[model samples]
Target: MDLTINDRVLVVFAEKAELPVAELDLDQTFEEIGLDSLHLMEVALWVQKEYGAVIPEGDLHHEQTVREALAYLDARTR
Candidate 1:
């Protein structure tokens, strides 16, 4: 599914982790989604696949918010 930044994060929370997007809080740490380090990698992989863009290796761990992740991608896509 084509998604905005918020949408992408929510989809990762939902589709991959089986959480409901509506239940996610924007300010909540992604930890609240219960992802471990491996899941973080999965999210990164999914993001890359969905966007057809590889997020830099380090940024995946650095970005703590959907908006920030999107900004990272936006900067790269330019």
Candidate 2:
């Protein structure tokens, strides 16, 4: 559970959505950067595969920001 990698994963998703690096604020919601449900599901799958963190469905709704996701993943890895 490398949090630095997890944080970079979040940024990669935002970058994939074509957002500028300067606008990739950790506190911003995924929706703020134009991530739809499908996009989020893809990100969830990536996290599961890359970090071995199993994120249940609908969990992303509870996490409104990248920081929140990082915290959730960090806790789960523990």
Candidate 3:
């Protein structure tokens, strides 16, 4: 099965956060999932490696929800 961009992003975040993908909610902020700046940076690096997209530093913040972050990355990937 082909995973959509949202699914791929959720998988990355879930893996980094040490949580099950089923537990990740799109509306939940990164803070809510216990992901800090370091984790976000790691995720950004992963995105860079996986998609060749350079996510802006400002976009990786605690206030950004999973869905919003996915959208930002998805936009750049396309």
Which numbered prediction scores highest in lDDT against the true structure? 3
Clashes of 3: 0
Candidate 3 global CA lDDT score: 0.90
- Full-model lDDT for every candidate: 0.61, 0.72, 0.90
Question: After best superposition, candidate 2 residue 12: deviation in angstroms?
Answer: 2.4
TM-scores, all models, native as reference: 0.64, 0.74, 0.90
User: After best superposition, candidate 3 residue 30: deviation in angstroms?
Assistant: 0.3
Q: Which ranges of candidate 3 are over 4 A from the true structure? A: none
Q: How close is candidate 3 to the true structure, as a TM-score?
A: 0.90
Residue 41's lDDT in candidate 3: 93
Q: TM-score: which is higher, 1 or 3?
A: 3
Range of the 10 consecutive residues with the lowest summed lDDT in candidate 3: 50-59
> Per-residue lDDT of 32-77 in model 3, one digit per residue for the tens?
9999999999988888898898987877899999989988888988
Model 1 agreement with the true structure over 30-68: per-residue lDDT tens digits: 566565567777877776776676765566552365455
lDDT of 2 by residue, 1-78 (tens): 654766667676666678776677778777776777777778778878877888887777624786786677667655
Per-residue error (Å), model 1, residue 63: 8.3
Q: Rank the candidates by TM-score, best first.
A: 3, 2, 1
Over all chains combined, what TM-score does candidate 1 have?
0.64
lDDT of model 3 at position 16: 84
Clashing pairs in 1: none
